[model samples]
Target: MTKKIGEPEKDMSFLDHVEELRWHLVRSSAAIFIFGIIAFLMKDFIFNKIIFAPKDPDFITYRAFCKVSRFFGTDGLCIDKIPFTLQSLEMGEQFSVHIWISITVGFIIAFPFIIWEFWKFISPGLYEKERKGAVAFIIVSSFLFFVGVLFGYYVITPLSVNFLGNYSVSELVERNIKINSYISLLRSSVLASGLIFELPIVMYFLTKMGLITPDFLKQYRKHALVIVLILSAVITPPDIVSQVIVSIPILILYEVSIFISKVVLKNELKKELKNG
Candidate 1:
Protein backbone atom coordinates (compact mmCIF):
# COMPACT_ATOMS: atom_id res chain seq x y z
CA MET A 1 0.00 0.00 0.00
CA THR A 2 1.11 3.57 -0.66
CA LYS A 3 1.48 6.14 2.14
CA LYS A 4 -1.00 8.79 0.96
CA ILE A 5 -3.45 10.08 -1.61
CA GLY A 6 -2.37 10.39 -5.26
CA GLU A 7 0.40 7.83 -5.01
CA PRO A 8 0.08 5.29 -7.78
CA GLU A 9 -0.33 1.64 -6.86
CA LYS A 10 1.98 -1.11 -8.14
CA ASP A 11 -0.66 -2.81 -10.32
CA MET A 12 -2.74 0.27 -11.14
CA SER A 13 -2.08 1.78 -14.55
CA PHE A 14 -2.49 5.48 -15.36
CA LEU A 15 -5.73 4.74 -17.20
CA ASP A 16 -7.05 2.72 -14.28
CA HIS A 17 -6.38 5.61 -11.90
CA VAL A 18 -8.07 8.00 -14.29
CA GLU A 19 -11.11 5.76 -14.52
CA GLU A 20 -11.27 5.54 -10.75
CA LEU A 21 -11.01 9.30 -10.41
CA ARG A 22 -13.75 9.79 -12.97
CA TRP A 23 -16.12 7.64 -10.94
CA HIS A 24 -15.24 9.51 -7.76
CA LEU A 25 -16.05 12.81 -9.45
CA VAL A 26 -19.29 11.46 -10.87
CA ARG A 27 -20.42 10.17 -7.46
CA SER A 28 -19.51 13.47 -5.82
CA SER A 29 -21.55 15.37 -8.42
CA ALA A 30 -24.53 13.12 -7.87
CA ALA A 31 -24.38 13.79 -4.15
CA ILE A 32 -24.30 17.53 -4.76
CA PHE A 33 -27.31 17.30 -7.09
CA ILE A 34 -29.27 15.33 -4.51
CA PHE A 35 -28.52 17.91 -1.85
CA GLY A 36 -29.33 20.71 -4.30
CA ILE A 37 -32.77 19.29 -4.79
CA ILE A 38 -33.31 19.36 -1.05
CA ALA A 39 -32.09 22.96 -0.85
CA PHE A 40 -34.38 23.97 -3.76
CA LEU A 41 -37.31 22.51 -1.86
CA MET A 42 -36.35 24.39 1.33
CA LYS A 43 -36.58 27.82 -0.29
CA ASP A 44 -38.31 29.67 2.54
CA PHE A 45 -35.82 28.64 5.26
CA ILE A 46 -32.78 29.20 3.06
CA PHE A 47 -33.81 32.56 1.61
CA ASN A 48 -35.83 34.44 4.23
CA LYS A 49 -33.58 33.46 7.13
CA ILE A 50 -30.13 31.95 6.50
CA ILE A 51 -29.05 33.81 3.35
CA PHE A 52 -30.36 37.19 4.55
CA ALA A 53 -29.17 36.67 8.09
CA PRO A 54 -26.26 39.12 8.15
CA LYS A 55 -28.39 41.97 6.74
CA ASP A 56 -30.56 42.04 9.84
CA PRO A 57 -29.48 44.22 12.76
CA ASP A 58 -30.57 41.56 15.20
CA PHE A 59 -28.02 39.11 13.87
CA ILE A 60 -26.07 37.22 16.54
CA THR A 61 -22.79 39.01 15.81
CA TYR A 62 -24.32 42.45 16.25
CA ARG A 63 -25.95 41.52 19.51
CA ALA A 64 -22.73 40.06 20.86
CA PHE A 65 -20.72 43.12 19.89
CA CYS A 66 -23.27 45.45 21.45
CA LYS A 67 -23.02 43.48 24.71
CA VAL A 68 -19.24 43.80 24.68
CA SER A 69 -19.51 47.54 24.20
CA ARG A 70 -21.93 47.85 27.13
CA PHE A 71 -19.73 45.73 29.41
CA PHE A 72 -16.83 48.09 28.83
CA GLY A 73 -18.92 51.03 30.16
CA THR A 74 -18.16 53.16 27.10
CA ASP A 75 -19.07 52.36 23.48
CA GLY A 76 -17.55 50.71 20.41
CA LEU A 77 -19.79 48.45 18.34
CA CYS A 78 -22.99 50.34 19.06
CA ILE A 79 -24.37 50.61 15.55
CA ASP A 80 -28.07 51.35 15.18
CA LYS A 81 -28.19 49.86 11.71
CA ILE A 82 -26.01 48.61 8.86
CA PRO A 83 -27.16 51.58 6.71
CA PHE A 84 -27.22 49.73 3.41
CA THR A 85 -29.98 48.49 1.15
CA LEU A 86 -29.47 45.43 -1.04
CA GLN A 87 -31.17 45.68 -4.43
CA SER A 88 -31.51 43.43 -7.44
CA LEU A 89 -30.49 45.41 -10.53
CA GLU A 90 -31.56 42.99 -13.27
CA MET A 91 -34.77 41.30 -14.31
CA GLY A 92 -33.34 37.78 -13.89
CA GLU A 93 -31.08 38.71 -10.97
CA GLN A 94 -33.37 37.35 -8.29
CA PHE A 95 -33.95 34.10 -10.14
CA SER A 96 -30.26 33.67 -10.89
CA VAL A 97 -29.40 34.22 -7.26
CA HIS A 98 -31.94 31.61 -6.24
CA ILE A 99 -30.48 28.95 -8.54
CA TRP A 100 -26.83 29.61 -7.71
CA ILE A 101 -27.48 29.99 -4.00
CA SER A 102 -29.32 26.68 -3.97
CA ILE A 103 -26.38 25.03 -5.73
CA THR A 104 -23.92 26.52 -3.28
CA VAL A 105 -26.05 25.39 -0.38
CA GLY A 106 -26.22 21.94 -1.91
CA PHE A 107 -22.44 21.81 -2.27
CA ILE A 108 -21.91 22.80 1.33
CA ILE A 109 -24.40 20.28 2.63
CA ALA A 110 -22.99 17.50 0.48
CA PHE A 111 -19.40 18.22 1.51
CA PRO A 112 -19.10 15.07 3.59
CA PHE A 113 -20.02 12.91 0.62
CA ILE A 114 -17.56 14.83 -1.52
CA ILE A 115 -14.80 14.14 0.96
CA TRP A 116 -15.82 10.51 1.06
CA GLU A 117 -15.56 10.32 -2.69
CA PHE A 118 -12.09 11.84 -2.55
CA TRP A 119 -11.10 9.41 0.15
CA LYS A 120 -12.44 6.44 -1.74
CA PHE A 121 -10.48 7.47 -4.79
CA ILE A 122 -7.22 7.74 -2.91
CA SER A 123 -7.49 5.39 0.04
CA PRO A 124 -7.03 2.32 -2.16
CA GLY A 125 -3.32 3.12 -2.24
CA LEU A 126 -2.70 3.85 1.44
CA TYR A 127 -1.45 1.44 4.06
CA GLU A 128 -4.11 -0.33 6.12
CA LYS A 129 -3.51 1.83 9.20
CA GLU A 130 -3.55 5.02 7.16
CA ARG A 131 -6.65 3.86 5.32
CA LYS A 132 -8.39 3.30 8.67
CA GLY A 133 -7.61 6.84 9.77
CA ALA A 134 -8.96 8.14 6.45
CA VAL A 135 -12.40 7.18 7.69
CA ALA A 136 -12.37 10.32 9.84
CA PHE A 137 -11.75 12.50 6.78
CA ILE A 138 -15.39 13.36 6.14
CA ILE A 139 -16.17 14.15 9.77
CA VAL A 140 -13.14 16.34 10.35
CA SER A 141 -13.56 18.15 7.04
CA SER A 142 -17.26 18.80 7.76
CA PHE A 143 -16.47 20.02 11.28
CA LEU A 144 -13.84 22.44 9.99
CA PHE A 145 -16.23 23.71 7.33
CA PHE A 146 -18.99 24.40 9.86
CA VAL A 147 -16.56 26.19 12.16
CA GLY A 148 -15.25 28.28 9.26
CA VAL A 149 -18.79 29.17 8.21
CA LEU A 150 -19.58 30.34 11.73
CA PHE A 151 -16.37 32.38 11.85
CA GLY A 152 -17.14 34.03 8.53
CA TYR A 153 -20.77 34.71 9.42
CA TYR A 154 -20.23 36.07 12.91
CA VAL A 155 -16.82 37.69 12.53
CA ILE A 156 -15.78 38.27 8.93
CA THR A 157 -19.13 39.15 7.39
CA PRO A 158 -20.19 41.54 10.13
CA LEU A 159 -16.86 43.36 10.27
CA SER A 160 -16.70 43.65 6.49
CA VAL A 161 -20.28 44.92 6.33
CA ASN A 162 -19.72 47.45 9.10
CA PHE A 163 -16.48 48.84 7.67
CA LEU A 164 -17.48 48.97 4.01
CA GLY A 165 -21.03 50.13 4.63
CA ASN A 166 -19.99 52.98 6.93
CA TYR A 167 -16.97 54.05 4.92
CA SER A 168 -17.73 57.30 3.06
CA VAL A 169 -15.77 60.16 1.49
CA SER A 170 -18.51 62.65 2.15
CA GLU A 171 -22.13 62.93 3.31
CA LEU A 172 -23.23 63.19 -0.32
CA VAL A 173 -22.45 59.59 -1.07
CA GLU A 174 -24.99 56.90 -0.19
CA ARG A 175 -24.23 53.23 0.06
CA ASN A 176 -26.68 51.10 -1.81
CA ILE A 177 -24.97 47.73 -2.17
CA LYS A 178 -25.94 45.55 -5.11
CA ILE A 179 -27.38 42.23 -4.05
CA ASN A 180 -24.74 40.28 -5.97
CA SER A 181 -21.87 42.26 -4.49
CA TYR A 182 -23.13 41.77 -0.96
CA ILE A 183 -23.61 38.06 -1.56
CA SER A 184 -20.15 37.86 -3.11
CA LEU A 185 -18.62 39.24 0.05
CA LEU A 186 -20.48 36.72 2.14
CA ARG A 187 -19.64 33.82 -0.19
CA SER A 188 -15.96 34.70 -0.47
CA SER A 189 -15.52 34.95 3.25
CA VAL A 190 -17.22 31.64 3.91
CA LEU A 191 -15.50 29.66 1.14
CA ALA A 192 -12.08 31.16 1.86
CA SER A 193 -12.25 30.33 5.53
CA GLY A 194 -13.61 26.89 4.86
CA LEU A 195 -10.65 26.14 2.57
CA ILE A 196 -8.18 27.74 4.98
CA PHE A 197 -9.43 25.61 7.84
CA GLU A 198 -8.27 22.55 5.90
CA LEU A 199 -4.66 23.55 6.55
CA PRO A 200 -3.97 20.38 8.51
CA ILE A 201 -5.28 18.17 5.74
CA VAL A 202 -3.19 20.03 3.19
CA MET A 203 -0.15 19.56 5.36
CA TYR A 204 -0.84 15.84 5.63
CA PHE A 205 -0.88 15.40 1.87
CA LEU A 206 2.19 17.58 1.43
CA THR A 207 4.06 15.54 4.00
CA LYS A 208 3.19 12.37 2.15
CA MET A 209 4.54 13.89 -1.02
CA GLY A 210 7.76 14.82 0.82
CA LEU A 211 7.05 18.40 -0.23
CA ILE A 212 6.70 19.43 3.40
CA THR A 213 8.90 18.46 6.34
CA PRO A 214 8.59 19.21 10.06
CA ASP A 215 12.14 20.45 10.28
CA PHE A 216 11.54 22.84 7.40
CA LEU A 217 8.37 24.09 9.05
CA LYS A 218 10.34 24.70 12.28
CA GLN A 219 13.32 26.32 10.55
CA TYR A 220 11.19 28.93 8.81
CA ARG A 221 8.90 29.39 11.80
CA LYS A 222 9.28 33.19 11.99
CA HIS A 223 8.74 33.53 8.26
CA ALA A 224 5.55 31.52 8.45
CA LEU A 225 4.31 33.74 11.30
CA VAL A 226 4.88 36.83 9.20
CA ILE A 227 3.01 35.36 6.26
CA VAL A 228 0.16 34.26 8.53
CA LEU A 229 -0.08 37.76 10.04
CA ILE A 230 -0.14 39.30 6.59
CA LEU A 231 -2.86 36.89 5.50
CA SER A 232 -4.88 37.70 8.61
CA ALA A 233 -4.54 41.40 7.88
CA VAL A 234 -5.70 40.84 4.33
CA ILE A 235 -8.74 38.79 5.36
CA THR A 236 -9.72 40.93 8.32
CA PRO A 237 -10.12 44.63 9.11
CA PRO A 238 -7.11 46.84 9.93
CA ASP A 239 -7.71 46.52 13.66
CA ILE A 240 -5.02 44.66 15.63
CA VAL A 241 -7.55 42.63 17.63
CA SER A 242 -9.30 41.22 14.57
CA GLN A 243 -6.04 40.33 12.86
CA VAL A 244 -4.71 38.72 16.01
CA ILE A 245 -7.90 36.72 16.49
CA VAL A 246 -7.67 35.34 12.97
CA SER A 247 -3.90 34.81 12.98
CA ILE A 248 -3.87 32.97 16.28
CA PRO A 249 -6.06 30.16 15.03
CA ILE A 250 -4.02 29.73 11.86
CA LEU A 251 -0.78 29.64 13.86
CA ILE A 252 -2.30 26.98 16.05
CA LEU A 253 -3.23 24.98 12.96
CA TYR A 254 0.29 25.35 11.57
CA GLU A 255 1.74 24.11 14.82
CA VAL A 256 -0.67 21.20 14.75
CA SER A 257 0.29 20.44 11.17
CA ILE A 258 3.92 20.40 12.21
CA PHE A 259 3.13 17.93 14.94
CA ILE A 260 1.11 15.72 12.59
CA SER A 261 3.87 15.79 10.02
CA LYS A 262 6.41 14.88 12.65
CA VAL A 263 4.30 11.98 13.86
CA VAL A 264 3.95 10.65 10.32
CA LEU A 265 7.64 11.01 9.59
CA LYS A 266 8.52 9.33 12.86
CA ASN A 267 6.31 6.35 12.05
CA GLU A 268 7.77 6.07 8.55
CA LEU A 269 11.31 6.18 9.96
CA LYS A 270 10.50 3.49 12.50
CA LYS A 271 9.06 1.29 9.79
CA GLU A 272 12.17 1.85 7.69
CA LEU A 273 14.42 0.91 10.61
CA LYS A 274 12.39 -2.27 11.12
CA ASN A 275 12.67 -3.11 7.41
CA GLY A 276 16.44 -2.58 7.53
Candidate 2:
Protein backbone atom coordinates (compact mmCIF):
# COMPACT_ATOMS: atom_id res chain seq x y z
CA MET A 1 0.00 0.00 0.00
CA THR A 2 3.04 2.27 0.01
CA LYS A 3 3.01 4.99 -2.62
CA LYS A 4 5.60 4.36 -5.29
CA ILE A 5 8.21 7.05 -5.85
CA GLY A 6 7.29 9.31 -8.80
CA GLU A 7 3.65 8.17 -8.59
CA PRO A 8 2.66 11.84 -8.25
CA GLU A 9 0.05 10.80 -5.58
CA LYS A 10 -2.42 10.34 -8.50
CA ASP A 11 -3.05 7.53 -10.97
CA MET A 12 -1.66 8.22 -14.43
CA SER A 13 -4.29 8.38 -17.14
CA PHE A 14 -4.11 5.74 -19.90
CA LEU A 15 -3.01 8.36 -22.41
CA ASP A 16 -0.20 9.45 -20.10
CA HIS A 17 1.00 5.85 -19.88
CA VAL A 18 0.86 5.59 -23.67
CA GLU A 19 2.89 8.78 -24.02
CA GLU A 20 5.54 7.44 -21.68
CA LEU A 21 5.71 4.17 -23.65
CA ARG A 22 6.09 6.10 -26.89
CA TRP A 23 9.23 7.85 -25.69
CA HIS A 24 10.75 4.53 -24.62
CA LEU A 25 10.04 3.15 -28.04
CA VAL A 26 11.56 6.20 -29.67
CA ARG A 27 14.76 5.88 -27.66
CA SER A 28 15.06 2.16 -28.41
CA SER A 29 14.44 2.80 -32.10
CA ALA A 30 17.05 5.57 -32.19
CA ALA A 31 19.64 3.26 -30.69
CA ILE A 32 18.90 0.60 -33.29
CA PHE A 33 19.06 3.08 -36.16
CA ILE A 34 22.37 4.57 -35.04
CA PHE A 35 23.95 1.14 -34.79
CA GLY A 36 22.38 0.27 -38.14
CA ILE A 37 24.17 3.20 -39.74
CA ILE A 38 27.46 1.99 -38.30
CA ALA A 39 26.81 -1.46 -39.71
CA PHE A 40 25.92 0.05 -43.06
CA LEU A 41 29.22 1.92 -43.11
CA MET A 42 31.05 -1.38 -42.60
CA LYS A 43 29.07 -3.11 -45.32
CA ASP A 44 32.07 -4.71 -46.97
CA PHE A 45 33.34 -6.40 -43.81
CA ILE A 46 29.85 -7.33 -42.66
CA PHE A 47 28.92 -8.93 -45.94
CA ASN A 48 32.04 -10.62 -47.27
CA LYS A 49 33.79 -11.42 -44.02
CA ILE A 50 31.18 -12.06 -41.27
CA ILE A 51 27.96 -12.89 -43.13
CA PHE A 52 29.57 -15.11 -45.73
CA ALA A 53 32.14 -16.75 -43.48
CA PRO A 54 30.10 -19.92 -42.98
CA LYS A 55 29.98 -20.55 -46.71
CA ASP A 56 33.73 -21.05 -46.78
CA PRO A 57 35.08 -24.53 -46.20
CA ASP A 58 37.88 -23.25 -44.03
CA PHE A 59 35.60 -21.39 -41.64
CA ILE A 60 36.46 -21.85 -37.97
CA THR A 61 33.52 -24.14 -37.35
CA TYR A 62 34.48 -26.39 -40.22
CA ARG A 63 38.10 -26.48 -39.16
CA ALA A 64 37.13 -27.45 -35.63
CA PHE A 65 34.81 -30.15 -36.90
CA CYS A 66 37.55 -31.49 -39.15
CA LYS A 67 39.97 -31.61 -36.27
CA VAL A 68 37.45 -33.39 -34.08
CA SER A 69 36.76 -35.90 -36.85
CA ARG A 70 40.48 -36.56 -37.27
CA PHE A 71 40.77 -37.23 -33.58
CA PHE A 72 37.91 -39.70 -33.85
CA GLY A 73 39.52 -41.35 -36.91
CA THR A 74 36.59 -40.47 -39.16
CA ASP A 75 35.89 -37.81 -41.78
CA GLY A 76 32.12 -38.07 -41.52
CA LEU A 77 31.76 -34.77 -39.65
CA CYS A 78 34.15 -32.80 -41.86
CA ILE A 79 32.67 -30.39 -44.37
CA ASP A 80 34.79 -30.06 -47.49
CA LYS A 81 32.86 -27.20 -49.10
CA ILE A 82 29.54 -25.47 -49.58
CA PRO A 83 28.52 -26.09 -53.19
CA PHE A 84 26.14 -23.19 -53.92
CA THR A 85 26.64 -19.58 -54.92
CA LEU A 86 24.51 -16.63 -53.79
CA GLN A 87 22.93 -14.51 -56.53
CA SER A 88 20.49 -11.63 -56.47
CA LEU A 89 17.80 -12.03 -59.11
CA GLU A 90 15.94 -8.73 -58.89
CA MET A 91 17.68 -5.50 -59.88
CA GLY A 92 17.52 -3.88 -56.44
CA GLU A 93 17.30 -7.01 -54.30
CA GLN A 94 20.92 -6.88 -53.27
CA PHE A 95 20.65 -3.27 -52.15
CA SER A 96 17.44 -3.95 -50.26
CA VAL A 97 19.00 -6.89 -48.47
CA HIS A 98 22.02 -4.80 -47.58
CA ILE A 99 19.87 -2.17 -45.89
CA TRP A 100 17.82 -4.78 -44.02
CA ILE A 101 20.83 -6.78 -42.89
CA SER A 102 22.42 -3.63 -41.55
CA ILE A 103 19.28 -2.87 -39.58
CA THR A 104 19.13 -6.40 -38.18
CA VAL A 105 22.78 -6.38 -37.18
CA GLY A 106 22.24 -3.02 -35.51
CA PHE A 107 19.35 -4.41 -33.47
CA ILE A 108 21.52 -7.29 -32.33
CA ILE A 109 24.42 -5.02 -31.44
CA ALA A 110 22.17 -2.62 -29.52
CA PHE A 111 20.18 -5.30 -27.71
CA PRO A 112 21.47 -4.46 -24.25
CA PHE A 113 20.49 -0.82 -24.64
CA ILE A 114 17.07 -1.76 -25.92
CA ILE A 115 16.52 -4.05 -22.93
CA TRP A 116 17.61 -1.30 -20.58
CA GLU A 117 15.07 1.07 -22.11
CA PHE A 118 12.39 -1.56 -21.73
CA TRP A 119 13.35 -2.24 -18.11
CA LYS A 120 13.13 1.45 -17.36
CA PHE A 121 9.61 1.58 -18.76
CA ILE A 122 8.47 -1.37 -16.63
CA SER A 123 10.45 -0.78 -13.46
CA PRO A 124 8.06 1.81 -11.95
CA GLY A 125 5.38 -0.89 -11.61
CA LEU A 126 7.70 -3.25 -9.73
CA TYR A 127 8.59 -3.27 -6.03
CA GLU A 128 12.02 -1.92 -5.06
CA LYS A 129 13.45 -5.42 -4.61
CA GLU A 130 12.16 -6.54 -7.99
CA ARG A 131 13.55 -3.46 -9.70
CA LYS A 132 16.97 -4.25 -8.21
CA GLY A 133 17.15 -7.37 -10.43
CA ALA A 134 17.05 -5.29 -13.63
CA VAL A 135 20.81 -5.31 -14.05
CA ALA A 136 20.98 -9.09 -13.72
CA PHE A 137 18.08 -9.41 -16.17
CA ILE A 138 19.87 -7.43 -18.85
CA ILE A 139 23.23 -9.11 -18.31
CA VAL A 140 21.89 -12.67 -18.32
CA SER A 141 19.55 -12.06 -21.26
CA SER A 142 22.25 -10.42 -23.35
CA PHE A 143 24.78 -13.13 -22.51
CA LEU A 144 22.36 -15.87 -23.54
CA PHE A 145 21.50 -14.03 -26.75
CA PHE A 146 25.13 -13.61 -27.77
CA VAL A 147 25.88 -17.23 -26.96
CA GLY A 148 22.95 -18.40 -29.05
CA VAL A 149 23.97 -16.17 -31.94
CA LEU A 150 27.52 -17.47 -31.83
CA PHE A 151 26.33 -21.08 -31.64
CA GLY A 152 23.96 -20.56 -34.55
CA TYR A 153 26.67 -18.88 -36.57
CA TYR A 154 29.49 -21.29 -35.78
CA VAL A 155 27.61 -24.59 -35.49
CA ILE A 156 24.10 -24.50 -36.98
CA THR A 157 24.92 -22.25 -39.93
CA PRO A 158 27.83 -24.35 -41.09
CA LEU A 159 25.88 -27.59 -40.81
CA SER A 160 22.97 -26.09 -42.75
CA VAL A 161 25.16 -24.58 -45.46
CA ASN A 162 27.10 -27.79 -45.87
CA PHE A 163 24.01 -29.99 -46.11
CA LEU A 164 21.60 -27.87 -48.13
CA GLY A 165 24.31 -26.31 -50.21
CA ASN A 166 25.44 -29.69 -51.42
CA TYR A 167 22.02 -31.37 -51.62
CA SER A 168 20.80 -32.22 -55.11
CA VAL A 169 17.60 -33.97 -56.13
CA SER A 170 19.24 -35.01 -59.35
CA GLU A 171 22.71 -34.60 -60.81
CA LEU A 172 21.17 -32.79 -63.78
CA VAL A 173 19.73 -29.99 -61.65
CA GLU A 174 22.03 -27.45 -60.03
CA ARG A 175 21.15 -25.56 -56.88
CA ASN A 176 20.91 -21.81 -57.30
CA ILE A 177 20.70 -20.16 -53.89
CA LYS A 178 19.11 -16.73 -53.97
CA ILE A 179 20.78 -13.95 -52.02
CA ASN A 180 17.69 -13.13 -49.96
CA SER A 181 17.03 -16.80 -49.28
CA TYR A 182 20.52 -17.35 -47.92
CA ILE A 183 20.25 -14.25 -45.76
CA SER A 184 16.87 -15.34 -44.51
CA LEU A 185 18.27 -18.67 -43.35
CA LEU A 186 21.08 -16.97 -41.51
CA ARG A 187 18.76 -14.40 -39.94
CA SER A 188 16.24 -16.98 -38.77
CA SER A 189 18.87 -19.23 -37.28
CA VAL A 190 20.61 -16.52 -35.30
CA LEU A 191 17.53 -14.60 -34.15
CA ALA A 192 15.39 -17.62 -33.37
CA SER A 193 18.13 -19.30 -31.38
CA GLY A 194 18.86 -16.11 -29.53
CA LEU A 195 15.23 -15.69 -28.56
CA ILE A 196 14.94 -19.35 -27.62
CA PHE A 197 17.87 -18.99 -25.24
CA GLU A 198 15.76 -16.72 -23.01
CA LEU A 199 14.08 -19.80 -21.57
CA PRO A 200 15.30 -19.26 -18.01
CA ILE A 201 14.13 -15.66 -17.95
CA VAL A 202 10.75 -16.71 -19.22
CA MET A 203 10.53 -19.44 -16.64
CA TYR A 204 11.42 -17.04 -13.85
CA PHE A 205 8.57 -14.71 -14.76
CA LEU A 206 6.14 -17.54 -15.20
CA THR A 207 7.08 -18.83 -11.79
CA LYS A 208 6.63 -15.38 -10.27
CA MET A 209 3.18 -15.17 -11.83
CA GLY A 210 2.25 -18.61 -10.41
CA LEU A 211 1.70 -19.88 -13.92
CA ILE A 212 4.44 -22.52 -13.85
CA THR A 213 6.54 -24.50 -11.35
CA PRO A 214 9.56 -26.74 -11.16
CA ASP A 215 7.32 -29.77 -10.83
CA PHE A 216 5.50 -28.80 -14.02
CA LEU A 217 8.72 -28.54 -15.92
CA LYS A 218 10.02 -31.79 -14.51
CA GLN A 219 6.83 -33.61 -15.50
CA TYR A 220 7.19 -32.35 -19.05
CA ARG A 221 10.86 -33.14 -19.42
CA LYS A 222 10.35 -35.89 -21.96
CA HIS A 223 8.10 -33.71 -24.10
CA ALA A 224 10.57 -30.84 -23.94
CA LEU A 225 13.38 -33.12 -25.04
CA VAL A 226 11.38 -34.23 -28.08
CA ILE A 227 10.59 -30.64 -28.98
CA VAL A 228 14.22 -29.63 -28.59
CA LEU A 229 15.32 -32.38 -30.94
CA ILE A 230 12.73 -31.29 -33.47
CA LEU A 231 13.93 -27.70 -33.22
CA SER A 232 17.53 -28.77 -33.65
CA ALA A 233 16.62 -30.77 -36.74
CA VAL A 234 14.76 -27.79 -38.15
CA ILE A 235 17.74 -25.46 -37.79
CA THR A 236 20.72 -27.73 -38.34
CA PRO A 237 21.42 -30.62 -40.73
CA PRO A 238 19.59 -33.93 -40.31
CA ASP A 239 22.80 -35.63 -39.29
CA ILE A 240 23.06 -36.90 -35.71
CA VAL A 241 26.20 -34.95 -34.99
CA SER A 242 24.69 -31.62 -35.97
CA GLN A 243 21.32 -32.26 -34.32
CA VAL A 244 22.96 -33.48 -31.12
CA ILE A 245 25.24 -30.47 -30.99
CA VAL A 246 22.31 -28.08 -31.20
CA SER A 247 20.07 -30.09 -28.90
CA ILE A 248 22.61 -30.29 -26.09
CA PRO A 249 22.55 -26.58 -25.31
CA ILE A 250 18.78 -26.36 -25.55
CA LEU A 251 18.35 -29.32 -23.21
CA ILE A 252 20.72 -27.72 -20.75
CA LEU A 253 18.72 -24.50 -20.95
CA TYR A 254 15.53 -26.38 -20.16
CA GLU A 255 17.14 -27.86 -17.05
CA VAL A 256 18.32 -24.42 -16.06
CA SER A 257 14.80 -23.09 -16.48
CA ILE A 258 13.49 -25.73 -14.12
CA PHE A 259 16.09 -24.78 -11.55
CA ILE A 260 15.18 -21.11 -11.87
CA SER A 261 11.52 -21.88 -11.37
CA LYS A 262 12.38 -23.69 -8.13
CA VAL A 263 14.42 -20.74 -6.88
CA VAL A 264 11.68 -18.26 -7.70
CA LEU A 265 9.10 -20.38 -5.92
CA LYS A 266 11.33 -20.67 -2.88
CA ASN A 267 11.80 -16.91 -2.73
CA GLU A 268 8.08 -16.28 -3.11
CA LEU A 269 7.33 -18.64 -0.26
CA LYS A 270 9.88 -16.92 1.94
CA LYS A 271 8.32 -13.53 1.18
CA GLU A 272 4.84 -14.87 1.99
CA LEU A 273 6.02 -16.31 5.32
CA LYS A 274 7.66 -13.04 6.28
CA ASN A 275 4.57 -11.00 5.40
CA GLY A 276 2.30 -13.38 7.30
Work out the TM-score per prediction. 0.91, 0.95
Q: Candidate 1 — which residues are off by over 4 angstroms?
A: 1-10
* Pairs of residues at least 3 apart in sequence or in different chains that clash in candidate 1: none
Question: How good is model 2 by TM-score?
Answer: 0.95
Clashing residue pairs in candidate 2 are none
lDDT of 1 at 40: 88
Question: For residues 7-86, could you state the per-residue lDDT of candidate 1 as single tens digits?
Answer: 55467888987998999999888988889889988989987888788778788888898899899985687777878888
Give each model's clash number: 0, 0
**CA RMSD of all predictions:** 2.6, 1.5
Top candidate, metric lDDT: 2
Name the candidate that leads on TM-score. Answer: 2
What overall lDDT, based on C-alpha atoms, would model 1 receive against the true structure?
0.82
lDDT of 2 by residue, 93-137 (tens): 999999999999999999999889988887777777788788999
- Candidate 1: residue 53 Cα off by (Å): 1.3
